[model samples]
Target: MPSPVMPTSRRADGHTSPAAVSAAGLRKSYGDKTVLDGIDLHIPAGSVFALLGPNGAGKTTTVQILSTLITADGGQAQVAGHDLAADPQAVRAAIGVTGQFSAVDGLITGEENMLLMADLHHLTRAEGRRITTELLARFDLLDAAQKPASTYSGGMKRRLDIAMTLVGHPRIIFLDEPTTGLDPRSRHNMWQIIRELVTGGTTVFLTTQYLEEADQLADRIGVLNNGRIAAEGTAEELKRLIPGGHIRLRFTDPAAYRSAASALRETTRDDEALALHIPSDGSQRELRSLLDWLDAAGIEADELTVHTPDLDDVFFALTGPGNVPNQPKESAR
Candidate 1:
């Protein structure tokens, strides 16, 4: 518990927006095994920062430390402008955490669970009930408010979990694998909810096994590998880190294909299929240059498509083999 270090002046959007969460040289170890090794993070206020890592790569541990659930073995962190070690209570007051597992009380009703959170936040009876009713309606749990949480579907229970987290009106929320075990539709619904949260100026720290989830919702993504951040950037920026990006052109006529292939010197050719794969970053300038070359050569391709390295590629490349561990297979997409 040292004094929290001040965040660096670097801004995500090139403006002066304050950081909602900042950590420097954060380290954590379990006995002889080190989980996190001097990690640094700077998440801007009112944005979604998704941390992507293979199983057991210290993602949960990072969230736990940031949310004040556990102390970092070594580091300085500030959450919502409060020092993590020096002012955990103030940090807790400013943040809400929804872990990988649901916190819904099955024995109690959904409304009761919300009331319990409200009580924990020291809300007055009238205020607690008012917030409970509003949250139930907001999460589409009004009809099941009085029913035991055990009877609710996985998606409904997750919604309730998030709704309960909001009872304290926390400015920052840490969601660790919030959409696990949910159907595609339910996952999409959860995404919409997260989007709405950030739209209202809330800062979100998310960790998910689902690469698509990070790709879709995160304003910035950090890929952790071997107890360190391998890369950090926007989805497109991460994709650009890998070298497989290319533009494929296919021609139905062999003559046209040969002519195009001869014009394009740096291309992988598939003579049997009459296709050529030209290395590209999928940038507008490169695509336009390719198109202009085809037009000038008077060669028409039957099809054209761009292929870029996705998050999955970046994950596999950075983490390598064996580090992936036990993540659900479906989430790799």
Candidate 2:
């Protein structure tokens, strides 16, 4: 078989790079129930790739296979430049994983837990202490470092879990539903942390059920459904894949509303609200043309807004009941 790892190339941002993670036709099954079905992925260095899906959609299974925590029943993968099957040890050394559940040892002090991770990575005692101190302070856990983790709030434990994951300085990190239970503020804070990691040249593989999380964080997103990738693209691109985009015009003056309604034959009229909905892709050219047409017709609208499909719309259309999966667009390397 050909190599799973591709050659280094330059990204649009002029960053010299190679694939941080790549896979092809990866498959896994639990008895008769197949999880991943011929899945493919290519994530570049220093980028975030979010896999989005509902529960039991194989997000964790894919993470396990790529992270070498479990073996795939078929296909190949390379992570951090090491062939997954041939050099799992090397792959393990270059990646860190923080699963959906917090890995904090609540019975121990937060500092002690950091020290334990430091030891697992085989750092010298002095080195361990130094990293543990820096990480705890960086994560703003210094005040609670000596306190039992059981006393920490949900957000605190989550932060501690990530700090522990960073103790090894892995280039690629797999975060499986990292913000599942975090409050809004905590979730935003975690998003900032993920951004900083990418800024510092770390590749992140995130799996999330939150459409907003995937929309905000991922450079590209792959929507998984029924053991397959329903579609894959940037948030805007995926949104464009579905319909329901339009331009809405509202008028306070009854005469203007009637005039516009008479002129625009294709618009859907809302007599009660004096609003008109015109089907549109909401592109710049379309908006300009619409404005010109209205001006020519001598019609003035009090309020105008363009409505386009968002990630939530894209998700439901692609993965909802009775929906057929679209062939995934080729992902950028």
Candidate 3:
């Protein structure tokens, strides 16, 4: 992996802090509606930390506060080694934000957008040209560089938008639903770019309603619920926390299925469907026991599949009204 570029925090006198990004008891609210309640986050210098939640779960508000685009109601957070409250400018300088909405201007040429960002960062004319040329090539937008951004495809526009954010060479980036309206191919492409960024040691702060996005890109995931972190861990750990996960055994005939079901009386039955859902915590012990039971029954299964609740289960269980909706969004942004 590439080394991270983020710096540590500041000294009391004037130097930067030692941590890449740190927060303790961060809080924010709108009127009486509390958006973030005593939230805590710690992101290392070169890792991707995903923040997940349902829509209206305050993921955007949290991103806004941490990126210095908005203030927190209470609590402290440090970014790029600078205290958010004490040095907002330093935080802004060290980080890039690709919001849910593309920042590219539709009327401008692709190359012109990159130049605009370069100008905002105050890069010299020669340096700006170098950056524009490099980013356009990197994002595969060179052929379309002279074309108006409005003419670009959804994927191309998204690519250009993110490339523009990279013009200043920020050490950390905040991506809020960067692939919201993209098709599967475009979303996958964005995922690849994000992976490359983290591999190159850029810290990624991602907020998305898509659990699949977090599963694919996050080094660590934090589930936000009711303005708080209900859970935080690696993807596997969170999945293990939920129940109804199982291993399925497919049989060639009804007799074999019936015999197996009889043998494993503890497992849940789906007779009409010719399948059995054995409750599992996704553990090897359970799998071994299941295999042993099958062997003892002398009923060989035609096929076997491991079933585990994904981030969707985790999200709905932890955040919703305790119900998983049939919304077709099992966390793929």
Count of clashes, each model: 0, 0, 13
Tens digits of per-residue lDDT, candidate 3, 1-333, equal 343344454444886533567888999888999889999887766778899987888999988998999998799887886778987988899999999998999999999999999999999999999999998998899999999999999899889999999999998999998989899999999999998888898889998877899999887899998999999988989988887766777776999998888877667888887888677776788888888877886778887778777888888889868586332222210
Error of 3 at 226 (Å): 1.6
Q: Which lDDT tens digits does candidate 1 get at residues 1-333? A: 564443544665776777899999999999999999999999988999999998999999999999998899998999988989988998998899999999999999999999999999999999999999999999999999999999999999999999999999999999999999999999999999999999999999999999999999999999997678989999989888877778889889999998888878899999999889888888889989988978887888888888777788788878876534232121110
The TM-score of candidate 1 is 0.93
For model 2, the superposed segments whose C-alpha errors exceed 4 Å read: 1-16, 322-333
Task: For model 2, name the residue pairs that clash.
Answer: none
Give the lowest summed-lDDT range of ten residues in model 3. 324-333
Task: State each model's CA lDDT, in order.
Answer: 0.90, 0.90, 0.85
Candidate 2 vs. truth: CA RMSD?
5.1
The parts of candidate 1 lying over 4 Å away from their true place are: 1-9, 321-333
Tens digit of per-residue lDDT, candidate 2, span 114-193: 99999999999999999999999989999999999999998899899999999999999999999988999999999998
Cα misplacement distance, residue 2 of candidate 1 (Å): 20
